[model samples]
Target: MSNDNAAPSSSSAAANGSADSAAPRRNSKRPKYSKFTQQELPACKPILTPGWVISAFLLVSVIFVPIGVASLFASRDVVEVVDRYETACIPAQNRTNKVAYIQSSANKICVRTLTVPKRMKAPIYIYYELDNFYQNHRRYVKSRNDMQLRSNSSQDDTSNCKPEDLINGTAIVPCGLIAWSLFNDTYSFSRGNESLNVNKKDISWKSDRDHKFGDNVFPKNFQSGGLKGGGSLNESKPRAGGSHCVDENCSSTNFQKVVWEDRGGSQQR
Candidate 1:
């Protein structure tokens, strides 16, 4: 009877213990938020509304607006400067009207008078482009041919002077007269004391009291025996110094000296 009672008591104790063990553990992941310490929980904030979103958009605009505007103006300034030097002072000529139109595109570039700002770091580039313009200016065959003839005569040391008089008063003409002449011979251009040499010589020579053109003219005695073997040409060396002066008869003439003065001017004193 005692053993039966002991077995029943033991079964009751085991049943109570099983019920306690089945209860949910406090540290399990299912409801872990409840176990979080006060310091471990994230702080809560109010939900964003339409007003907050609008305010944020205005804040971004205030920061970037001035930056964009400044950049636009800077770009425009760069474009203006480049355009100034790109166009021609004279517009391109066309078939209808063969004359070129004068247009002021850039300040004329000159070496001595380099008046324009040399902001360009690459001088070789500037020189190349300038040369191209000059070549195009000379390509008009008919116009250039006529202009060349005129240019040569315009600065002719013999111009406006009678053959009888070696020294004449100072004559002033265009600067292109000297520039073109030297360019033909040397393929370069320059302006300096040499540019005004013609006037300087003439002015100094005029101070002589006695001046005659015939004294400066070439003598007719030295004509190169009118070509050989029936050729109507005169192969003689023209004028003494080989200047490009020819008589109305097409006879070659030479210069005694570059100075324009009568042959006997120094002896007159």
Candidate 2:
């Protein structure tokens, strides 16, 4: 009876071992779906046919050709003339004089003759370009007080004007980079035999519409005389030899002369 029971137990153990080995083989033989492994992911395969390539080139040419022609014609119409008078003024000689004359005659004025190659069209615009003059610098630009410009008796805002704004309770009228660094260069133009006139007052913006400085608020210590404190810009003056003041105090004033020419009419500077 013992031997019979032992034989049955051994046969049952062998059957369990065979079932475990078959399970692994069945899992390995399972078929993998091609849709889940490869076909589900996207891929780009560009087909660059000659027709598509030719169409793109034609579209670009159609849009840009007319634009290029129009730009060329417009550029041809404009005629610009520029003259930089680098060394126009000649220094005066003082070799003999012991005292050395402080203000020399030569340093006062500089005159140059510019001949135009071709006559410019009607309404010719003239501008002076200062290459080294940096008006956009941080220290030079933010040197003015807006409150002081609008008010005559207003105290100096030290944060804006710094060491110069408030000297002894008197407010520096137009204290800033714009007022300090004033352009003093003057220009005159003569075309052929006719002397062109430049209207300086018209070049600046209208105070009523643009500046809007209150009537009560007048520039303090303002010099009315020719370029003394800062020239008086309110009055209209001729573009001739006279020094027309454009600043409230004509000390350091930008002397920009704006000239306008009419078609077929006498030239108005």
Where model 1 places Cα greater than 4 Å from the true spot, the runs are 1-44, 72-269
Clashes of each: 10, 14
* lDDT minimum window of 10 residues, candidate 2: 257-266
Cα miss at 269, model 2 (Å)? 9.2
- Mark the regions of model 2 whose C-alpha exceeds 4 Å error after superposition: 1-50, 90-107, 151-159, 167-169, 202-217, 222-269
lDDT per residue as tens, model 1, 134-184: 322332211212121223343334332222112234322111221111110
What lDDT is obtained when candidate 2 is compared to the true structure? Answer: 0.48
lDDT of each: 0.31, 0.48
Per-prediction TM-score: 0.18, 0.55
Put down candidate 2 lDDT per residue, 51-117, tens digits, no spaces: 9999989999999999999999988878877677644343335434522332233454556777767
Clashing residue pairs found in predicted model 1: 89-103, 163-213, 164-212, 164-213, 164-214, 165-212, 165-213, 239-253, 239-254, 240-254
